[model samples]
Target: MTRGVGSMQDTFEKVIKHDELFHEEVLPRLKKLEEVQEEFRVEIGKITASQTSLELTVMKDGQQTRDLLGRFVDHYFGTDDKKLVLKEKVTLKQLSLRAKIALGFIGVLGGSGGILAGVAAVIEILKN
Candidate 1:
């Protein structure tokens, strides 16, 4: 009867140790997994909302019936009308320096005009 009591006590101690190991190790890991899953759920919800907004914009732009991807294909194949003219690809070295110079000139002129307008406005304010 004493040997039986010792065996029962040993079995109970082993069970308690196993329970303690699981509670200390496995429970924390399970909680971490739950937190990661919740973050993933939130990210997926944001992605879904963004997709819905894009779809709404496409529909509003009257491009719903025309497959959005098909437009790209049509443009690539040069099937789109003049309104959807495909852009010409230009290699960097192949570009006309004259065009670059013209663009630069226009930008400088526009910037100077804006500065003059601001100065004129300030002068008018000072005079007033």
Candidate 2:
């Protein structure tokens, strides 16, 4: 009975020693590991924020590029609105030059011929 009691006491002491060793050795290491894990989590959060900002920048740049391309096409290819404005300017300049040339030619016609030529030229322009 004494031997059996001594064996049980030895086993119980070993378990207590193991528990104490784990508390003394493993607990601090685990706490340090948790701190390191928290640092990694913080780093991951920062990386995520940076990635989000970069994505937004890329999206904005892409939108700007598209807008620039649209403007370039409108300028070069002449969208309908722009084409109408350009056509009006050209027509006005041509009409002014034609009127001047016709008046000069009528000057050469002389007297009543000049007046008749002027009227005819005006009528022709209006008809077109």
Candidate 3:
């Protein structure tokens, strides 16, 4: 009975030493692994934020490109709300030479028009 009791006490002592070894050796390693995992989680969060910002920048650049293309088309083809000539680009500009020519023609014909009207009136009076 004393031998059996000594064997049981030896087993209990071994269990306590194993528990102490586990606490001294394994627990610090587990704590360091937990810290490394937390660091990895923080790095992953930073990468996610960077990826989201890059996506937004890409989207903004795409929208700006579309807007520039629209403006280019509008500048070349004119807007939707106005008349346009296809064969020739027309910008309305008045020439003083054309105005001078029109004035000369008016001055040359104005006296003849009044004289012809007066002659018609005279002929009607003679007829009466």
Candidate 4:
């Protein structure tokens, strides 16, 4: 019974030492770490809010520019007499043939060699 009592006392002293070390050493560092984490979180929130505000401003400006350009086009170019007039009347059969030719041309241009050639042709045309 005395040996058991001595063991209990030893264990109690060890636990007291550990509790003192935890309170003196670990607790303050843990509190500091928590404070730093809170600061980082606040900074991230500020950066995200700034980015969202900038994106909203850019979207509003783009919408305003698009509305202004659309109004200008309606004022200047919205007339029946300003419409394009084809030289020949296109029949349904001719339209179908033209569509087929266009599809074939697009298919050819989809190939790598054809894409290079088409780019070269466009560059030449632009140069001219």
Candidate 5:
């Protein structure tokens, strides 16, 4: 019985640690990617509406050039990959949460008595 309890504790710790990591690393990256996508969409719309067909130029250190969309595409897509990465991270987070909830429910249901008894046992454990 102690061994089973130990295993459960270990698994719970692992899940909580992973949740923290995901919240720190993945969520921020997703937010940045979303911002970049919105900016890119706005720029594309402006570029498309410009009637002159003037070559888009970027000026840096007194140097001006064309190929604005190409450069922007590279930077934008590079950042947007974070969106895909975030989707995978979110799926993992959701799966972990679901598993934790299911484990708690199972612990209640399968522990020899019904819901009230399971709650009592949990309360008793907490009191200790």
Candidate 6:
């Protein structure tokens, strides 16, 4: 009990003090950290789900968007799948590159006969 700094009793008391400090202070902070960590995990999960869906640019509601820009007004719980999905107020026309290129050519060309007449039919369909 009368020993100096090198005493075993002194080291033991220091250890107990540190332990009490951990229980009183560090434990509660650790608990709050766990809650924040869980929230981050949930947010990362949502981000991962969005990433997966974006790979195909398809929503659970059988609607597709552009692979790059994508489309949506907001997200909602789907009626069928009951999963989070984007609500689309607008649907972009999915056109083939060939059709788009052909349309460009047709736009450049004025009214004509023969082969142009066949293209005119396609243009009529594309216009809508």
Please estimate how well model 3 matches the true structure, expressed as its whole-model Cα lDDT: 0.72
Between candidates 2 and 4, name the one with more favorable lDDT: 2
Preferred candidate (lDDT higher): 1 or 6: 1
Comparing 1 with 3 on TM-score, the higher-scoring candidate is: 3
Model 4, span 1-128: residue lDDT tens? 46565598789898999999999999999999999999999999999999999999999999999999998888776553344233223342354544545544665568857665455545444554
Q: Rank by lDDT, highest first.
A: 2, 4, 3, 5, 1, 6
Q: Write the per-residue lDDT of candidate 2 for residues 1-128, one digit (tens) a residue.
A: 46565598889898999999999999999999999999999999999999999999999999999999999987787777788899977875677647755764665476757766677666657766
For model 2, the local distance difference test gives 0.82
TM-score of 3: 0.56
- Report the C-alpha lDDT of model 6 over 1-128, residue by residue, as the tens digit: 58997799989999999999999999999999999999999999999998998865646334433432242323221343333222221211355546655664665564555456456556756766
Computed on alpha carbons, the lDDT of every model, listed in order, comes to: 0.70, 0.82, 0.72, 0.73, 0.70, 0.65
- Model 6 Cα shift for residue 107 (angstroms): 33
Residue 27's lDDT in candidate 4: 100
Error of 2 at 88 (Å): 16
Candidate 1 overall lDDT versus native: 0.70
Give per-model CA RMSD.
20.5, 12.7, 15.5, 15.7, 44.4, 18.3
**What TM-score does prediction 4 earn?**
0.51
Mind giving the per-residue lDDT tens digits that candidate 5 earns over 1-128? 46565598889898999999999999999999999999999999888877334433323422423366667887899789988899977874565444545545676778655575456555544655
TM-score of 1: 0.44
